[model samples]
Target: MSSSERACMLCGLVQTEAEFVSKGCANCQSIFDKAGVDTIDCISPSFEGYVGMCKPNKSWCARWLRIDNFHQGLYAVKVDGRLPVDVVDLLPHYIPRDGSHVE
Candidate 1:
């Protein structure tokens, strides 16, 4: 991939194919050097409902996000609508199945 392919979320530095999906880079370390909040804590919460609240209805396409510092989470972005059951099945093994708080 090229630098324009995808940039690191933590830093504005452009990424090549090798680092397209990396959690962070040297630039990220510099940016977060004095930051108070953990960049990984800023993950989007759209999938929380599907994986935690609605796990008995299979009506959406859900998948887990495997990024570092953002593990134990699922994403249902490609899904058409809410899907409880499918979300449950797609939950990562690291996540609890007892409908516990996943934030």
Candidate 2:
């Protein structure tokens, strides 16, 4: 791969940073699609989509980011413009009815 391109950390297919991280390539996106994943914008999701997606500018969008929040699958969000709101109430579409989040 040329220095201008970076190998997708998951699929190892070289691509631009913007494509690999923010907007995935065809192969990676296809895999996500097959797995029922959607890259909807994190903060302002359509609420009818699958898993939430992050923008390249968001701190969590960085491939190097490592955290303990819901296996990093759950991102922090505000409800009613407040912090520390209940997870379910914050993202009713993402959190399960039984109060169980993706493990």
Q: Kindly give the number of clashing pairs for every candidate.
A: 2, 0
Q: How many pairs of residues collide in model 1?
A: 2
Q: Cα deviation of 63 in candidate 1 (Å)?
A: 38
TM-score of each: 0.21, 0.24
- Compared with the true structure, model 1 gives a TM-score of 0.21
Judged by whole-model lDDT over C-alpha atoms, candidate 1 comes out at 0.31
Per-residue lDDT of candidate 1, residues 1-103 (tens digit): 2223333332123334344335544433433434443433322212222232123133232224223232222222221122233333433553432234367
Q: Per-residue lDDT tens digits of candidate 2, residues 28-102? A: 355444444342211121112122224423545334222112122322221111111332233344422122234
- Cα deviation of 64, candidate 1, in Å: 35
Model 2 Cα shift for residue 101 (angstroms): 30
- C-alpha lDDT of all candidate models, in order: 0.31, 0.31
After superposing candidate 1, which stretches have Cα over 4 Å from the reference?
1-4, 20-24, 29-103
